[model samples]
Target: MSRYVALGSSMAAGPGIRPSAPGAPFGSGRSARNYAHLVAERLNLDLVDVTFSGATTAHVLHERQRSARPQIEALDGSEELVTITIGGNDVGYVPLLMAASLPAIARRLLAGRVRELFDRAARERALDDVADALRGVGTAVRGRAPQARVVFVDYLTLLPAEGAPAAPLSVEHADLGRFVCARLEDVTAAAAQATGCELVRAGHASRGHDGWSADPWAVAAGLPLPWRPAPFHPNAAGMRAVADLILEQVGKN
Candidate 1:
């Protein structure tokens, strides 16, 4: 039997929305739908779900190095596939962007000087930290499962557009979102190249301003629970979209 190990954050763990299965957690009032389970079901592989809510790449390394609680040894000696979606929480980048944007909104509420200052600093730090974390994740995954086909997925773009109005604020939030996503892509791609791991560009499937204009994947922000997470997290449909993209890449590899 081909065994698969999936490691990452709540997105990989299927927090808000995922395909239903026995023993799955139920909290966000949505079915436990994670892309890992979806990929496993699609490919009919034995899945080792080593994912947790609020996980970062650094967290994964610590757990592996120390065999800490929620250790990834649960997926040790993997046989075939290894999918990872990490680095979003590292440096608390996402929250930082949200925080920085809030005060700017309290003032003039535009992507002006204040937004620029916060975004530039946050993006630089996040990129560097995430790159380091990806290196660690790549090394750890390769060490554990030498034969497995490892994949590192990039974060999805969450911003609206240049001139669109964003909820709870202005379109400036979208700009920061784009900046963060772009940096994530760079670090993930570079790390994958350095570590000889396959890169999965999950961001392309996201509904950006243009994509949302045609076909939106996630609910509008500040709508309601089960529609969207706090702000950056995906809804059920968004998770499913991610699962689909992951399965596609996994199948090709």
Candidate 2:
């Protein structure tokens, strides 16, 4: 079997999904059913999954997360495949989504501060950090595994399209969430192009399947259910969708 190393944050780890990945640290929050595991099963790959919840690119490239090695450190020149799904945490995408889900009174009370955090200038600055870190990841991976097929899978869409009724989000906050999501998608795509890596347009493939859609691939913000995905994260269905999307490219090659 060819070796495959998966890297990234909660979006890739499938936090709170049932049946924790065998031997994964509790803090990692990795699901046995996450896209990486699923892809490995279908392709019979020797998988080294290093994804953890709340990982920033810093964690993937250098910082030890929850005492585990930096995610990139899991790689060696022998691997044939790698997949990355990161950068949302760097720009506070999930935090903003959580803020949007606060109760009406709480949201109103915190609106000013939240708006400041999402200010266009601040967001752009954070995005610059994300872009640079992604470039670093691409460079390090290429150096470590010159023969691997690197794939940059961007985040799934988390919000309803513009003008859709997104409950829990007042119109203003909903609009703000959409804008941030879009910018993150753009940055991820640009990084993949600049790195000469294969790209999986998960965000584009999930357009009408946002958390607010009838058949949501992503989990909408709400009370956490036992063994279910955390709010603003991918659900099992989303994981399956992503796995299949990945196979579409890998199987062809």
Candidate 3:
């Protein structure tokens, strides 16, 4: 059987929104039916889920450097496959994006003084530091698993419902969100290229869908919870979608 490795944050961790029962597949927040598990099951491969809730690229690096256990340790020899989905929590921007509207936030940005808000938050929140850390991660992965096929997953665009009551977001906010994603894509792609890794455009899969839309792989509010243990994780359907993507990529490789 092929050995596969997965790395990233809450999305990878399966923090379901619904409450988790004891000994459940996933604890609280998202569900255990995240994309990784889905892919693993489809491939019938042994999977090492090296993901943590609220993990940042920097955190990934720090943990690898400090651990010796298989789950927490750095990659050793090259494997058949490896996937990473990180960087959302680096700046802690997801919460802001989810809570506020871009149009309302953009007004503040155009005021010239608003740039400070972004810069301050990026600096204080460790967003600005992610690029270098990601590069380092790429280098490390390559060094340890030189022959393994590495894949990096990107974030998707997030939009609120049409005319939904939401926190004010200025046009600038929306633009900035797009801008941030673009930069992230560029940086992550660069890292993947440098490490000989493939870039999996996970975000593209979410296009044309808002957070509230029924996502086979995503557990959001108002949806009937799937896993009894991990309510926020993906249901079986969601897992299938993720599995399909991975299987497709693996076949290509």
lDDT (CA) per prediction:
0.65, 0.89, 0.58
**Error at 248, model 1, angstroms:** 2.3
lDDT of 1 by residue, 193-219 (tens): 889899878776674722244454443
Residue 181 error, candidate 2, Å: 1.3
Give the root-mean-square deviation of each candidate in angstroms: 4.6, 1.7, 6.1
State how far residue 60 of model 3 sits from its true place (Å). Answer: 1.3
**Would you list the rank order by TM-score, best first?**
2, 1, 3
In model 1, residue pairs whose N, Cα or C atoms come closer than 3 Å (at least 3 residues apart or on different chains), thus clashing, are: 17-33, 18-33, 19-33
Better of 1 and 2 by lDDT: 2
Which stretches in model 1 have alpha-carbon errors above 4 Å? 18-31, 64-71, 97-119, 207-214, 223-230
Q: Which stretches of candidate 2 lie over 4 Å from their true place?
A: 104-116
| Cα-lDDT of candidate 2 | 0.89
| lDDT for residue 97 in candidate 2, whole number 0-100 | 77
User: What is the Å distance of residue 107 in model 1 from its true position?
Assistant: 11
Q: Which ten residues in a row have the lowest lDDT in candidate 3?
A: 19-28
Using alpha carbons, what is the TM-score of model 1?
0.79
- Sequence-dependent TM-score of model 2: 0.95
